[model samples]
Target chain A: MTVTRSKAASIRAARRDRWAQRLVQCGLHAGLMAWGALAVYPLVWVLLTSLKYTRELYADPFGLPKHWKWSNYQEAWVYAKMGTYFLNSVLLTVGSLILVLFLASTAAFALARFEFRLKGLVWGYILFGFLIPHSILLVPLAIFTRQIGLYNRLGGLALVYAAVGIPWNVFFLRAFMETIPKELEEAAIMDGAGMWSVFWRVILPLSQPALATMATFHILSAWSEYILALVLTGTTVSRTLPVGISLLEGHFTSNEPGVAAGMAITIVPVVLAFAFLQRYVIKGITAGALKG
Target chain B: MRRGRKRGTSWYGSPVGIFLFVFPAVGVYTALMLYPSLLSLYYSVLEWEGGPISAAPFVGLANFRQMLSDPIVPLALLNNGRRLFLDWAFMLPVALTLAFVLSRLRRGASVYRFLFYIPVILPATTMALLWRFILSGNDYGVLNSLLRMVGRGEWVRPWLSGDGYVQWSTSFPASWQHVGFYMVIFLAALVGIPEEYYEAASIDGASGWQQLLHVTLPNIRGVYVSCMILTLQGALGAFIYPLLMTKGGPMHLSETLISYSLYLLWQKKTWGYGSAVATLSFLLGIIAVALVWRFGRQRESALYR
Candidate 1:
C-alpha cells in the first residue's frame, strides 16, 4: 500500500478525530447530566419550597429562601392534620408489614415444600387473584369492610394491605424457599423437630434475607398506597398521609408553602428508606416484576 | 422399596398441618382480595346507596346501561388511550436511550443510576403534588417562574387547566417517575448481553448509533416487551395523577377509567354504576394485557435477522 498523505498531516488528522470523539462524548454526558438534574429537581424544589413562607415562595419560587420558615412544617402537621395522617400511615404500614410476613412466610414454606391434594388449587387461587386488576376490588371491598365491621379502622386497612400483599409475597417467598437445599430441613426433621419447629428454627432462619427484602419492599408500597387507603378510610383521623395530602389541595390550596410542607412530610420517609435500603428494595421490585 | 415422591416424612404433608399452614393466608386473601374483586361483578348488577350492600335494590344491568350512556365514559376512555400512547411513545424510547447512554459512559453511571430512580420510589401523590404546583396557572408556578427568569414568560401557561393541556401535563410527571424504573430494567438486560456482540458489531464497521439499532435494541427486546406490559398496567390504572393534579378537571376532561369510577363511588355514591365501570375497566386491562402478551412476544428471534 502507498501512503496517501505526509506523515505529519496524517498524525494531525488522527489527533483531530480523537478530539472530535471526545467532544461528542462531552456533549452526550452533558445532556445526560441535565436529564438527571431535571428528574431530581422536583423533589428538591418542593422540599426547598416547603421551607419558604407563602409570600417569599411566590416572590422567588426558584431561589433559596432568605429566611427558612420551619413553621410551615408545623402548619402542615397541625392545621392540615398531616400529623394524624403521619401516625396513621406509620401504624398501618407497620401493622400490615407484620401481618404479611407471618402469613406469607408460613404459606410459602408449605407451598414450597409439601405435597398436598389441594396445593395446586390453592396456588391457582392466589394466581387467579392476579387476573383481576386491583381497581376492580375497590367497590366491593369498601362495602364488604363496612358490612363486616372493619371499615374506617386502621387495623382493617392493615388487613386489606396484608391481603393485597399475600399473592405476590407468597409467590416470591415460595420461589426463594424452593431454591433452599433440602439438607437443612432433613437435618431438622431428623432431630425430632415437628413441622412447626422445623420452620421456626431451620427454614425461617434461612429465609431471613428474603424476608427482610420483602419487608422493606412492603413498607415502600403500603406506605405510599393511595386509592385503597382513600376508599377504605373515612376521616382525617383514619386517613394516611397521601390521601390527606390529596385533600390538602382543597383546604390549603391558597397556602402553597403549607401544601409543599405536606408534600415534604409525605415524601421524606420513603426517600430516606430508599436511600439506605435501596439494594434490597430495587432487587425486590425487579424480582417482583417477574410475576407480571 | 422406593419412597413415595408424592408423600413426605414431615408433618407439613399431613392434612391438619396443611390446613393450619395455609388457612390464614388463604382466608385473608380470599376475604380481602379474591372475594371483593369478584364480588364487583355481582355488585355491578345491583343498586346500592350508603348502607350495607345486602339491602340494596337489585337492578339487573341498569348500571351497565347507564355507564354506556354516560358522556364522561367516552372522554375518560379517550384520556386513558392518550395516556397509554404517551407512556409507550415517551417512556420506552427515552428510557432505552438513557439506559444505553449510561451503559456507554466511562464515568458517573452509579450516581446517575441512584439519582434517576428517586422519583420512582416517591408516592404517586407526591409526584402529582410537586407537578401540580410546577404547572400552576400563575406566575408563582415553578415552570412559569423559570420561564419568566429566562425571558420566555410569554410561553408560560397553565398546564393542568381544563383543556387539552390537562391530559398532557401529566405526561411528564408520569414519565419522570417511571423512566428511571424502565431504565434500570433495560440497563440490567443490557448488562447481560455478552460483550462479544458489540465487539463483533464494531468489527462489522457499525457506528455507535448503528450498534444501538442493530445490537442493543434487538438484544433488549424481551425486556422491552415486558416493559410494554408493565407500562400498559401503569397507564391504564393511573389514578393519583388525575386525582390530584386535575381532580378530573374543570370539565372532567382528564378522567381515566379508574379515577372516574372512583369519583362515581366516592362522590356520586352510585355504587352499582361505579362497580360496572370498575368491572369493565378491569376487563379491559385483562384484555389489553393478553393482547400485549400475544403481540409483544417475538416468534422470530432478532439474532437470526
Candidate 2:
C-alpha cells in the first residue's frame, strides 16, 4: 500500500512540475509580445498618420483617417524637393561605399595575412579614431577641407566619410578574415596565384558576409548624416535628405502631422530596401557581431 | 610556406610589404583626420572671429581661461552625465531582460529582432520628428490623448516649450532611438554565452537567478564595457535630438557643448571660440574613454581566475 501511494505521489509531483514549466513559458511569451507591440507601434502609427488628410490629422491624431492621402508621398517627393535630395544622398552613399570598401578591404587583407614590424602601433593607431567624438573632429575636418579645393564638393565629403569608416571596417573585416583557413591561401599560392589574384579570387569571395556587414552600416551612416552634410553643402544641388527634410520643419511651423507625413514618405525607400534584403541583413548582423 | 620565405628576400617584396604599401591611406588619414584635430587645437589658442581675409591673433590659453570661467560649460557636462546615467538605467537592464526572454522562444526570435531594429534604419530626423508629435502638448498628441482617456488630464503639458521640463523631455526621445542599437549589441553578447555553462549550473542544482549571476554576467563583461564606452561617447556627442526637437531649447536649456559650438561655427561664425569648445570636448572624451578602459580592464583581469 505504501509503495502504491509513493508511485501516486511521484506522478502528482511530475504533473505539478509540468504545470510550472507551462506557466513560465506563457509568461515569457506574454512579456515578449508586449515588447514587440511597443517596438512596432511607433512605425505603424507614423505610416497611418502619413495616409491621413490634413483635416483628419488635426481633428484626430490617434484615429484612422476616413480617406487615405497617398498623394502626400507624391507631394513630398516633388514639391518638397526630396527627389533632388534623394539623388544627392544616393551619390554620397555610393561614393562613400566605394571609397570605404576599397580602402578598408585592402587594409584588412594586408593586416590579416601579413606579419610586419610596428604592427601593434598600427593597430593602436586605427583604434585611436574611436577615442574622439566626430563633433570634436568636425571643426578641424571643415578647416582641412576648406584649405583644400574639395570643401564644398561631393568628392571631399566622400573622402571624410571614407576616412572615418576605414578604421572600424578594417577592425571588423580583419577579425573575420583572420578566421579564414590559411591552407586555402597556401594552396592558391602553390598553383602560382599572385597576391593580387589570391586576394581577388580567394579572399574576396570568402569575405562576402563581412563586406555586406560593412556596406549596411556605411549606407545607413551616409544616408542619414546631418551635421557634416549640413555644414558642407552650400546649395540645393548638394543637400542630402536629412537637411531637405529639416527644411520641411520650417514649412510646417510645428504642424507635426505634416512633418510626420513627410518623414513617413522619406522612410519608404529605405524600409523597402531593407525589407527586400532582410535575409542578407540578418546574416550580416549575426556574423558581424561574432567577429566584433 | 616556401612562397612566404621567398617573398621576404626584399624589404618591400613580401605580403607584409603590402601592408606598408598603405602609405596612401595613411596619408589620407593624416591629412583629413589627424591634421584637422591638431589644427583645431591650434585654433583653440587663437582670438579672432572668423573672417575670410584676416589673420587670427594668438591668444595663448585665453580660450582655456574663458572655458573655465563659463557657466554653460559645466551645465553641458552635467547634462551629458545625466544622459549617460539615464541611458544606462533604462536601456541596459531593459535590453538584457528582453534579450533573455527572446532567447527562450522556439520561434519568431529573428523576426522580432528585425522589427525592433527597424527604427535604427530610419533617419534621425524621422525619429526626432516622430517623437515631437507623440510628445506634443495638445490633447490631439498621442501621449496626451492616451493620458486623457485614462483621466490623467493634469499630466499633459507643453513638454518642450517650458524650461522646467525641456531637459528631461528632450532626453526621452534620444534614449528611445539609441536603445535598440545597444539592445542588439547586448543580445549578441548574451547569445555568445555557451549553453554548457547553464547546463552545468542546473546539474549543480542552481536556481535561475543564481545561474544568471554566476554564469551569464561574467561572460558578458567585455560587451558591457564596450557598450558603456559607446553610450558615453554617444551621450557627449548629443546634437541631433536637441537640434531637431528643441532647436536647443525654449531658452538654451537643452544646449550641449557641440550644439553651442556648432551655433558659433555655422550661425554666429565665431570660429576661434568654437574651436576652443571643440578642443574641450575632445579632451573630455579622451579622458572619459581612458577612465572606462582602465576600470574595465581592472575588472576583467580580477574576474579571471
Candidate 3:
C-alpha cells in the first residue's frame, strides 16, 4: 500500500512537469509568432497600400484595397520608367556576378592549391579588404572613375561592385575549395591535366554549390546597392532600380500609393528570390558567420 | 602516385599558371579598391573642389585639423555611438534570446527562421521607405493611427521629423532588418554546440537556464565578438537609412558620419572636407575593429584556459 501511494505521487509530479513544459512551449510559439508578424507585416501593408487608390490610402491606411489596382505596377513600370531601371539593375547584377565568379574562383583556386611567395601577405592584404569601409573609398573612386573616363557608366558601377565583392567571394570560395579533396586534383594532374584544366575539370565542378551561394549573395547585394550606384550613375539610362526608386520618391512626393507601387516593384524580385532560394541564401549567410 | 607527382611539377604547379590565375583578381581589386583607398589618403590633404588632381592645392594636415574642430563631426560621432550602444543593448540580447528559444524547440524552427529573416532580404532603401511610411509624422501614419486606436494618441509625435526622435526613428529600420541576421548567426553558433554538453549538464541535474549559462554562452564567445564588431562597423557606416528616410534632417540630428561626409562631398562640394571625414571614419573603424579583435582574442584565451 505504501508503494502504491509513492507511485501515485510520482505520477502526479510527472504530470505537473509535463504541464510546465507545455506552458513554456506555448510561450515560445507566441513570442516567435509575434516576431514573425512584425517581420512580414510592413511588406504586406505596403503591397496592399500600393494596390489602393491614393485617396483610399489616405482614408484607410490600414485597410485592404477596395479595388486591386494592378495598373499601379503598370504605371510604375511604363510611366515611371522602373522597367529601364530594372533592366539596368539586372545588367549590373549579372555583370558583377560574372566578374566576381570568374575572378574570385580562379584566385581562390590558386590560393587554395598552390605554393607561392608572399602567400600569407597576399592573404592578409585581401582579408584586410573586408574591413575597409567602402564609404572611405567613395570620394577617390568617383574621382578615379572620371579620370578613367568611365564616369556615369553602368559598366563602371558593375566593375566597382565586382571589385568590392571579390574579398568576401575569395574568402568564401577558398574555404569551400579547401574542403575539396586534394586527391581529385592529383588524379586530374596524373591524367595530364594542366593547372587550368584541373581547376576547370576538378575544382569548379565540386565548387558549384558554393559558387551558386556566392553568386546569389553577390547578386542580391549588387542589385540592392544604392550609394555606389547613386554616385556612379547620373542618368536615367544608367540608373539602377534603387536609384530610380529613390528618384521616384523625390518626384512623386504627394503620390504615396504610386510611390509605394514603385517600391513594391523594386522589392518583388528580391522577395521572390528569397522565397525560392532561401536555403541557399541562409546557407550562404550562415556560412559567413561560421567562418568568422 | 609517381605519375601524379611528376605531372604536378610539369604543368599544374607552374608559377606561370599561378600568376595567370591570381593576377586578374589582384589587379582589379587593387585598381578599384586598394588604389582608390590609398588615393583618398592623398586627396584628404588637398583643397580641391572635385577638380583635376594637378590643379588642387596641397594643404597638409589642415583638413584633418579642421575636421577635429568641427562641431558637426562630434555630433555625428556621438550619434553613431548612441546607435551602436542601442544595437548592442537591445539587438544583441533579443537576438540571442530568440535564437536560444528557437534552438530549444523540436519542430517548425525553420519556418520561424524563414519568417524572421524576411526583412533581411529587403534592400536597405526599401526598408527605409517602408519604415518612413509606418513612422510618418502625420496622423495618417501607421504608428500614429495605432496610437489613436488604443486611446493614447497624445503620445504620438513626429517620429522622423521631430528633432528628439529622428535619430532613433532612423536607426530603427536598420535594427529591425538586422535583428534576424544576428539571430541567424547566434542560431548557427547554438546549433554548433555539441549536444553532449547539454546532456552532461542535464545528467548533473542542471536546469535549462543553468545549462545555457554554463554551456552555451561560454561556447559561443567568438561568434558574439564577431557579431559585435559587425554591428559596430554597420553603425559607423550607416548611410542608407538616414539618406532615404530622414536625409539627416531636423538640423542634421540624424546624420551619421558617412551621410555627413556624402553631404559634404556630393551636396556641399567640399571634396577635401569630405575626404577628411571619410579618413576619420576609416581610422575610427580600424580602431573599433582592433579593439574588438583584442577583446575577442583575450576572451577566447581565457575561456580556453
Docking quality (DockQ) for each candidate: 0.46, 0.44, 0.58
After TM-score superposition, what is the CA distance of residue A10 in candidate 3 from its true location, in Å? Answer: 4.2
| TM-scores, one per candidate | 0.91, 0.92, 0.96
Return the top candidate by TM-score.
Answer: 3
Sorted on lDDT, highest at the top, how do the candidates line up?
Answer: 3, 1, 2
lDDT score, candidate 3, position B267? 90
Q: For candidate 1, lDDT tens digit of each residue in B52-117?
A: 667989999898888778999998888788877877888888888888888888788878888888
Ranking by TM-score: 3, 2, 1
Between prediction 2 and prediction 3, the one with superior TM-score is 3
Candidate 3 lDDT over B1-305, as tens digits, reads: 13233455475667887888888999999999999898888888999786677998999999989987888888888778877987899898989989999999979999999899888878888778878888898867888988888999898999998887998888777877888889989998899899999999999999978997899998888899999999999999888888888888878888889989988988998888888888888888999999999989987898789
TM-score of model number 2: 0.92
lDDT tens digits by residue: candidate 2, A1-292: 9999999999999999999888988887777777777877777888888788877877777788789877777767777777788888889889989988888887788778887777777777876776656776776777667777777778888888888887788888888899999999888777666666567788889999888878877887788888888776777788888888888866667455566667776687677777766666666655545543
Q: Which lDDT tens digits does candidate 3 get at residues A1-292?
A: 9999999999999999999999999999998999999899878987998898988987888889999998888888888899999999999999989998999999999999888998888888888898778888888887789889878898888889989998999999999999998898877766777777788878999999999899888877887898888888888989998888888866677788888888888888988887887788878868877776
lDDT of 2 by residue, B239-296 (tens): 7887888877666787777877777777778788878887787787788888998999
Quote the lDDT for A290 in model 3.
76
Give candidate 1 regions above 4 Å deviation: A1-25, A250-253, A285-292, B1-10, B49-55, B203-206, B298-305
lDDT to native, each model: 0.84, 0.76, 0.87
lDDT of 1 by residue, A164-205 (tens): 999889988999999899999888666666778777888899
> First chain TM-score in every candidate?
0.89, 0.87, 0.94
